[model samples]
Target: MNSLFPILAIVRKDISVWLRQPTSIAATVLPAIAFMVILYFGAQAVGRNPVALVVQDSGPHAQELINILSDSGAFKVTMITIAPQKAEDALRQVKVAAVITIPSNFDAAYNAKKPDPVTIHINNLNLDFTNDLRRSLPAAITKFYADQSAINGNNSPIQIRVKETDLRSQDIDLLRFELVPNLVLLLTTAGIVNAGLATAREWEDSTIKELLLAPISKATIITGKLLSGWITTLLIAAVVLVVGAASGYLRPAGTIYWISTLVIVLLIALASAGLGVAIGAASHRFQRVTAIGIPLSIDLFFLSGGITVAAFLPTWLQTIAHFVPTFYGTHALQMAIFYSSNEGLILDLSVLGATAILAGVLGVLSLRKSMLA
Candidate 1:
């Protein structure tokens, strides 16, 4: 009861001070909105990528394939009537993201009921473009082949049916769906920077001596700071959720989803607040803390695979990502918001739990030493 009183008092006082500073609230909320807007618009602008259509087969079936590619609206099909060697040259010169070739015997194979192969030569320079080609080209082919098969009376020997079972049945916009996990990561960053700065600010203002003279253990003081930071982050997260829902970037799933999200957010807040405390205690100056904290937050977020897909990264980078807490934090948020199931939820929560424990203990120890010195 003795230590608890001071901890609660500190938390309340800190929250009161934080609310009075309007810039702090704006600093936390504005960046999250900006990132969501940038990502949403960037995804929209990536459509209609340029692709080379090298037609060697002058058959009706070949023309049908060409028409399908052009009509899909996924690509800007540049019809290239050059030889295969020149087609390769165009790819090397970066004229297009990929080249789909129709062989000379395309109609002959179709007429004889034999297998016909459409060649796709892609520039592997951009993974995002490559992924687009890999997915869209096959979908176009599937649509065309299905239409052709229906016209031919369904006498085919083998029929493959592709069924996609989506985990989320809600009619949420894809851009909005993709933005949720990213928003979680951004909230974590805000939590860390502001919390870390709060501690550093105390040192810069020479207020540590007052805390040292107080009749309270350093652990209780650190606990107060951590709780204050975590509470502030949750408040910021509420703002983020409200803004995202209002902007149509997020939809409330249900009680379970909100519960799970709140849990993950709490864990992330604890871990990030701990890290911020540690960094602040180590730096002891607001300027040094910001210099180190901002870059550190960006690096951790990148490693977390919040903004970019991690599978396309180098093997070494992926390996490094497994050790970071945000990776699991982002993963947990995705599972809660999009999956609506507890698949791998235990493992994700466990990693974050352990991280919070370790970081919080280390932060307390660091602050203890600083105050005693």
Candidate 2:
């Protein structure tokens, strides 16, 4: 109880200091908010594309084709008209990605079993948009043929069927999928900035000498500092988790899954807090610690699969990401929150637990050495 008093006092003092500093709080929270805003806008850009559809044939077959294209959930058919020149103008002005025309001979070709090509003029500006247009057209056409086969019995030319089986109960949208990493980023920033600033403040305010002279052991000081940061991070994380759950982004399977999520979050906060202590002790200046901590956390966020899946990255980049602690953190979080499965979770927890221990030890040693120096 006597030794614990110093640790508790240190934690209390550091947390009080953190609460008094508004800049430190903003520095921790704003980056995660900014990233969420960026991802929201990015999701809009990559969603369904706009295209022009020119229908020259006033036949039932053409009308059916038009309905299929509109309902395919791929293209936003911005303009539907019989005017080829109008489509040309829209294409030239970059108003649409492509001009798809169902020619006058479409009905004639179908009745006579003749080959009639539906003309498409693509903007071909970039591969992403270009490929989207290319793939969507074929899929729409396949659906059209499938419908025709159903109506006309064995007379239809092509028959292709696709049956899908989903591994999970729900589909995670792009924005929601990204929310996990942003939450991780928030916890990491809070942990590092809170603890780092607390440690650096001692040097900046000329209070390190007092701490060195105090009756508390160096280990107690380090533990107190880390606990303060970890506690602060967990508070921030709680708010984030509540918001995430209320917004429908995070849905744990049951009590066990919720427990798993909390464990992962706790380990992440501890590891981040330890790293923060090391930075603060080594830099010994408020500005220097802030500078180092923010950029380093951001880099770790990206390397740990920020907005994109690490598996889809270049081979060397994926290899580097595996070395990052947050890679395991991110993977574990996604599994628990989204998949509701424990697959590969053991490895993730093991890595995070080990990292927390190693970082804590490094932080303690670094602060102790600084105290002696």
Candidate 3:
């Protein structure tokens, strides 16, 4: 027990020294803010947006759907009385998201209680808008008839507005939602630069020999090195949290949401740091560790749905996501942000804890072998 004391001292000292470097905080924060808040919105306007709307059939059912879409605040819907050929130019130039073309038989089919053959000419690039239109249009058709029956003698149809409360704020911005997990994954890998390089750097600087000569067990030496990595990562993550708050990624609306995000990030960082040290110890060659560490971390990102949503994914994909640390990391972040989701926080922490334990044990073993050899 006394032997463990010296190693803990060294770990504390290393963290203290690293924090004294003024630029340490900057390295962790700027990327997360820039990628999440800046770059994404900068180029968003260049993507295809809405302007033109075409209606071949002037029926209450079709127009009611358009009104619902117009109210969404997502698009600026303009009435286009022009030919489809004229609308094609704007769609091609990406000025319009889609042409809401109504079939001449639209009202006839509705009155006859048959399926309408309305065609919506959409540019494949605007999948988000296209999907929204797809769902809204069908719903509007159902609502139109429901309302018409509600009225006494008028042929006019009424539209139904389903008030979907975005309990998680995910609906507000899909782009922003996608950006957070990548930031988490990137931060996790960034930890490797700080954590993986710690022991290797001490050896190159000729400090490890002095550390080993001190009154400490080999386990203490490993403990100190791992703690140094973990603490530095925590500091970096702290800066990241502040930056996320300042940049509006972490909002007051989801207090519990943000808390979960923080817990998940810390847990993943702990697991990630252990994995980083394992790379350093097993390879023994510092350059090789740096070379291999990033790619392996990236694999976790891909497996975790870092670039996409895990919800629509196949069940097999969901199964695969569990083994990756970022799977729990990103999923938990999303739940906190959008749904105020807190159901599985404990389970996520457990998975992350298991990862940290396994990776940490492996890391300690590798460090001991490398140091003693």
Could you say which candidate leads in TM-score? 2
- Give the per-residue Cα lDDT of candidate 3 at 138: 61
Candidate 1 per-residue lDDT over residues 226-316, each given as its tens digit: 8887888888788777876676555446888778788888888888788788888888887877788778777877887755666567899
List the pairs of residues colliding in candidate 1: none
lDDT of 3 by residue, 207-295 (tens): 77787787668887887777777877777677667766776665524666767777777777777777777777666556876787778
Write candidate 2's Cα lDDT for 198-236 as tens digits: 888889898989988898888888888889878988878
Task: Report model 1's TM-score to 2 decimal places.
Answer: 0.75
Better of 2 and 3 by lDDT: 2
- lDDT (C-alpha, whole model) for all candidates: 0.78, 0.85, 0.69
**Cα lDDT for residue 279, model 1?**
81
Off by over 4 Å in 2: 30-46, 88-95, 123-125
Rank ordering of all candidates by lDDT, starting from the highest: 2, 1, 3
In model 3, the runs with Cα more than 4 Å from the true position are 1-27, 39-51, 55-66, 72-85, 102-118, 125-133, 143-173, 203-207, 214-216, 245-248, 251-263, 332-342
Highest-lDDT candidate:
2
